[model samples]
Target: MASSESSLFSMAGDSYSKYEIRRRNPNPTAAALLVIDMQRHFASIAAPILPALRSTVALCRAAGIPVLFTRHRHRSPADYAMLGEWWSGDLILDGTPAAELLPDIGRDPGDRVVEKSTYSAFAGTGLEEALRGMGVEEVIVTGVMTNLCCETSAREAFVRGFRVFFSTDATATSNKDLHEATLKNMAYGFAYLVDCKRLEAALAPKI
Candidate 1:
């Protein structure tokens, strides 16, 4: 694609995400923020969205909302599962710095980090149980690969009976088409689509 066309695609997604239409407003009393796969590799491509994500994290923290992050790591070929053949190269190797969350997100030591080897944070993970244990009813999903990890996790959350709030500006992807597709898919059926400023503002008044 030409540089101009790519830029146009980027602008189009930004325009579409400007509106914060949602199926439901997150109940601050029963909400959690799932920051999925915000590691070095994807985070570098999606760096522009981190400011919005960082601000959202701050608001959630102030509100005493549970903020959990998922680190995508494969310890061995056995653990790779479908992700092994789906992607062309090794990703988020265990014990490597690349597998760790980016340093700029202001993650505290007390914060929880769930390690996963798949796209959905809930897959083969204790995320569901942990949320249930916390008495969380709503999950505000944010992080990298909007069409992949974010979308899958949102749908999984919905099926598990958690009200899903998908973050438009706070989630990022390398391609605009895939990102927009996820947003539309979530808005059409699975989750309430939200943006950074609006979500932050809503949480602010209560925090």
Candidate 2:
């Protein structure tokens, strides 16, 4: 969990609810979509957001944007790190279907996949370097557990200097409250909170 002390990094009051988020057209060559931890373990919690994710991914693809997916896995006890302790020893092991990315999304041959072992994709992962190498300046985030992995990556991206755009309707958590809190926090501080429809429209190709 992130510290809530920073006002623009983790706002937790009624004022945050009044933020008016505006949609912007991200430069296709300078943006990437991060699909984080939408695996079997979070299937039920993530189901409702699949349509929105699918649409966002499709639009990104059509616009020539890179769609990067991160699958969280623990290959062995040695791979667990502090996450295991924090999760009370629970692990999403490798070679198990539980750690696999959901097949329903519109995955493409040009898409990239990065494997991670922690809550934040940038932790122990070369995600930042990879994004930098691709000339990516803005990042669009979507995936499971709005209050956890998704939120963590959004904050990480912001602090690392990437313009962060979080999909408000394309990410999910176990419950509504958890999802809403993270949305408010992100809107108040870390990223621009966008809906699927607004994003698709903003990314629409010019005729």
Q: What is the lDDT of residue 103 in candidate 1?
A: 84
Q: Candidate 2's C-alpha lDDT?
A: 0.78
lDDT string for model 1 (64-154, tens) is: 8889999888888888777777763756788877776888885889889998888889988999999999999999998877887888999
Worst 10 residues of 1 by lDDT: 1-10
lDDT of 2 at 190: 85
Residue pairs with colliding backbones in model 2 are none
lDDT of 2 by residue, 19-47 (tens): 54643556777999999887876677667
Q: How many pairs of residues collide in each model? A: 0, 0
TM-score of each: 0.89, 0.87
